[model samples]
Target: MFQPWLATLLIWIPTLVTAGDPAETPWISLKPENHNGKHIVFVTGDEEYRSEEGMPQLAKILSKHHGFHCTVLFSIDAENGCIDPGVLDNIPGLKALDDADLLVLFTRFRNLPDEQMKHIADFVESGKPVIGLRTSTHAFDIPNDRKYHRWSFRNDQWKDGFGRQIMGETWIAHHGGHGWQSTSGIIPADMKQHPIVRGINDGEIWDPSDVYTVRLPLPDGCIPVVMGRVLSGMNPEDGPCEPEERDGKTFDKNNPIMPLAWVRELKGSSGKTQRVFSTTMGASQAFTREGSRRLLVQACYWCLGMEEKIDGKGNVSIVGKFKPTSFGFNSHTKNVRPKDLLD
Candidate 1:
C-alpha cells in the first residue's frame, strides 16, 4: 500500500530544515531557547493510528511549554524522500539518538537496517530512558535471517522482543472491539497520590482507540498506573461494560480493567536501572484529549528522574491546531515533506 510521491526528495532535501539540523531525511525539530539541556527524539513510523501526526504535536507541546529540544523522525521513501509509514526499512536520524536524553518511539513492526537499528540497540542497552506508545511494543519486525533479528517483536531468542524485554509487553491482541469499541482510563484508587497521575482522575481517560490486551503480571519490575476500561460507547462519558466470565472466573470487565499505562525499571548494559514508560494509548486521535497528553508529559519527567519537578497544574497545552486524520492503513497525508510540518 505504498503511495507514490509527487516529487523526488532530491528536489527538497537540501532546503528542508524544521529544526535546522539539515539531515537528508524527513525529520522535524523544535529547539526552545528557554531551555532544559535535554533532547527528546521522537520516532514515528506506524502505518495505522497516525503516529506521524501525534508525534509532532507532542514535540511541539514539549518544546513550547516545557523548554525541551525535540526532534521527530519519520519512515521515509528513500527514492522520493517522502514520509511513508508503509516503507518500514528507512527512518533517518538515528544519529539523533546518540545525543538524545530520551527517545519516545511510536512505531509498529519496523524492520530497520543494522546500521540504523544498532543505534536503538545501543540506547536500550545503555539504560537510557524511553517512552513507548501504541504499536511500539512490537516495533521491530525484522526477518530471522537479518543480523538484528534478535530485536524483532516476537523473536524466540529474545522472548517476545523489545517491548517485552525492554519496555513491558510485545504486541498482544485487542481486548475490546478494534474500531467500534472505545476505551477509558480508570486510575487505581490507591495510586492517586503518585506524581504521574497527579492531575489525572478516574474516567477522564477517553479515546476512540480500543484497549490492548496484555497478559497478567507484566515483566516483574513493571508498575501499573492507569487501567483501560472497555466502554459500551465512544463518548468520554460512556458507561463501562460488565466483565465477561470465562473458565469459571468472572472477569469484572470495567470493575477491574486492563492496565493500559505502566512504568517499568530495567537494568541496562550500563549497570543502571533506567525507567521505561509504556502505554497502550497515544495515537493521533488519542492525543486530541488533554488528559492523555498530560499523562505522557508527566511520564517524561518520571523517566528523566525529575519527578520532583512535576506539579499538579503543570502546563501541557497544545502549541498549535491539531486536526489529525483517522487511523487507517494508507491514510497519511501525501506530497508533503518534513519541512511542511513546520507550518
Candidate 2:
C-alpha cells in the first residue's frame, strides 16, 4: 500500500530546515547512499538518563551497519539551540516522521506542544512500527489542559496511557535498588528460541541500570523476551541477588524476576495493530556490552518485519568509539549540537 504522502517523502529524502527561526533545534541525520529505502526516526529526551547519546549510537549502527537511513531528534534549549534533555517542552523536527518507516522513542516525561506531538500521534495512528527504550514507558508527562494529555504515563481516559495501553507498562517502581543494584538479562526459557534473543547470551545481557517492576502478566498481549536479574554489583560478573522484602511485600528479583525487554502490538486509533518493541535495558553504559547491543539490533529487524535478515550470529559490532556518559539528572554533555555528536 503506497501512501501518497509517503511518495512525497521519498522525493524530499531528508529532514527539512526551519528557516527564519533564531534558535532552531539541531537535528542529526544519516542517509546512506546505498539505502534500504526505509527511514528510522529516533526521538531522544530525558532528564536523568543519557538518552541523547544512546539515540545517536543506535542510529549510527542502523544506518552504517544495516543500511537503513536514520534521523535523530533531540530535546533542544530553544534559547541557545543546544541539546538539552532537561528542557522537557520542545523537541522540534518531529515532522521527519512524515517519511519515517519506524519511530525509535527514548523520551521521558515530555510535554511537547500540539504541533510537535501531532507528528508522533499521527505516526502512531498510521500504524507504523515503533521501538521504545528505558524511560519511554513514561515518555510523556502532559498537563490536563493539553489535547494530548491522554498520552501521558498516567491517565484516566486511556487508563495508564501509551505505555500500558500501547507499549506494555507505564512508570512503575524500580524492582532493584535505584543506583546501588545492577541488572543482567536472563532469557526466559520460552523466549530462548525467539529472534530477539537468538544471538544474545543470558549472562551477556547486563546493565548498570536496575530492573523495572512490571506487572506479572504484561498487558496488551506483550511477550516477555528478557528478564532482568538484579545484580549485587555493577559488573557483569556480579552475583544475582534475591528480591528483598520491603514493608509487607517482597520485591521479586530472582524468583521470577521482572521483564527488561519485550514487544507489544499497539492497537491504534487508525484501527491498525502497530508493531512496538520496548526495553528497559538501553542505558548508555549497557551498549558497551555486545549482548545488549545485539538484543536491540535484533529487535529493530523484528519490528521492521525483516526478521529473516537477523543472520542469527548477532553481528552487532559497535560502529565507532562509543564512550557514553553515565546516566544522571542533567548529565548530558552541555553546549552540544546534533551534528557535533559525530565529531
Best by lDDT: 1
- Candidate 1 ranges with C-alpha deviation above 4 Å: 1-17, 21-25, 242-252
Over all chains combined, what TM-score does candidate 1 have? Answer: 0.91
lDDT of 2 at 48: 76
Winning candidate number (TM-score): 1
- In the predicted model 1, the residue pairs found to clash are 9-80, 243-253
lDDT of 1 by residue, 257-310 (tens): 689899888877699988999999866878878888888888998999999989
> lDDT value for candidate 2?
0.82
Please provide, for model 2 over 19-135, each residue's C-alpha lDDT reduced to its tens digit, 9 standing for 90 to 100: 223234388777665578888899999887788887788777777767777888999988888899989889988999998999999999999999999999988879999998988
Query: Listing every candidate in turn, what is its Cα RMSD in Å to the true structure after a full C-alpha superposition?
Result: 7.2, 7.0
The TM-score of candidate 2 is 0.90
lDDT of each: 0.84, 0.82
lDDT of 2 at 216: 79
